[model samples]
Target: MKYLFGPVPSRRLGHSLGIDLIPFKTCTYDCIYCELGRTTHLKDKPAAYMSAKEIKAELDTFFANHHPPVDFITLGGSGEPTLNANLAQIVEIVKNLNKAPLAVLTNGSLLWREEIVNALLKADVVLPSLDTVFIKTWKKINRPHPLLKLETIINGLKGFRRKYKGQIWLEILFVRGVNDTEVEIEALHRVLEEISPEKIQLNTVVRPPAERGVEPLTKKDLEEIKEKLGPKAEIVVDFKRPIEERAELLNLREEIIALLSRRPCVLEDIVHALGAHINTVIKMMDGLQKENLVDAYLHNGKRYYLIRKGER
Candidate 1:
């Protein structure tokens, strides 16, 4: 599964099967809070990063296999998926599979392009992030490409809302001392009204971020922000559904390694992802830590595990 990873747990999409279309670290913005680290290939132009035929073939094989039920067939992994020039073709291919509702998780930086917006029209849901409304804050937080403009990006989102019929869940990730100021929030509130997304999801740093000194806001802070954003807004909480039981466990150790290699996960995330008992996950973590294959760090109140830097 070179391109696809996880029927992994998601707070918004339930158990999402992720499809990676772009190469690792290729994105339009290099945000400080990115869990997968900094964007190494920062470009705005879309390219044929992977063959659509190969992706479709992988999806075909995936549907043929007996696996856990997934809520969404998500097009997002490692980088900005919209960077793949074959986005519309890939979307068509996934919709043809008809396994589950398709969703696109993007940064929404390129949605200003008519072709990019048109390419996403077939998706069941589009989850795009707009971290800030002010150009200064946007630059400081998102660190977007030189060519990107806040006004243009906002217009793109507004235009997309007008044309697309599917639901849009616009995400705004808040980082303390950055884009969480009263003026910034007020500006965002005004812009969000114009964008008019079906849902406004507020998120913060839950995992280890790319840069140091990046801090998450309190639940209290998020609740207040939600209040300010009105009825359509809600805090993006952790996935709390009961883990589905599997008749036969897959290679638990390898699965854990594969997951951690992509992004750090807490104990609960590992349990939910593998559908294994917490004790079992803990034992595996102990072994991996002993082998120096993985390492753990505390963020906020929860502990997160990831593949050791040297191992990765």
Candidate 2:
């Protein structure tokens, strides 16, 4: 309840239960279009960011109830999860509790470390973001740590590919005017060929992005990237999410408030948990907040929701 966020429906991961290990914004890069906004502590180091025991205890509570099933247990939430020294331990615990595949969505900065790669080997899926291929583009898009080098990151990814056994899904999040150029795409192509990921997921900024009006890549531009990346590239439309029933959808927005009374749930986590359409959930959340049924707060750049009493 404290560390686990959701059994939310993900377009990529299906029903995902999120485990946030590190403190908010404690990542190596500060992506411009990050839904969580600007990074505060832009550092990536292996440390005891959070305890494996604590995370395990949270999972124990959730599994004890065993109300619903999740498609996967995801290691991502407030910050880059790999920074937490206990990530491997957390992954093992998640696997023991829920046999569902454990997925980790990361920025891919730390893949250079063998220890990190070894830690992540048991995961079913590892979604790593490589926003740009060239160093300039990398800086423009990710704004990485002053000490982090593009070459090192690339080599690290290559090394990870050779050693890691799980399926690697490479994610490239493009901002309109930042790293969407032909040259950048070509570099990405080369990198993709080297990484040989099982999938290439193309994405864009659609949420309350860190910078407003960063602009979404036009259909034509996205098409060009898709063509350049060849058959491997697949664009994840900024919109659309997993949902089944409208009645269940409505209950999600209301139930979400009660659910978060135990832990903070993010926008994506809520959508995944309820398996409700994102737009529908957003509209209802707006109305609920207008009536003061729930509370929305930003912690270290990431927004989270919780139920507020004496309102709804």
Highest TM-score among the candidates is held by which one?
A: 1
Error of 2 at 91 (Å): 1.9
How would you encode candidate 2's per-residue C-alpha lDDT over 17-129 as one tens digit per residue?
Answer: 88878876788988888766678778858788789899888877887785577888899986688888887788888777756888999999999877788889888899999
Write model 1 residue lDDT over 190-304, tens digit each, in one string. Answer: 9999999999999998765779999989889999999999999999954222123221323788899999999999988888887764534665687799899999999998999
How many angstroms is residue 235 displaced in model 1 relative to the true structure, after the best TM-score fit? Answer: 0.5
For every model in order, what is the number of clashing pairs?
A: 0, 3
lDDT of 1 at 88: 88
Q: Which pairs of residues have clashing backbones in candidate 1?
A: none
TM-scores, each model vs. reference = 0.79, 0.77
lDDT of each: 0.88, 0.80
Q: Model 2, poorest ten-residue lDDT window?
A: 238-247
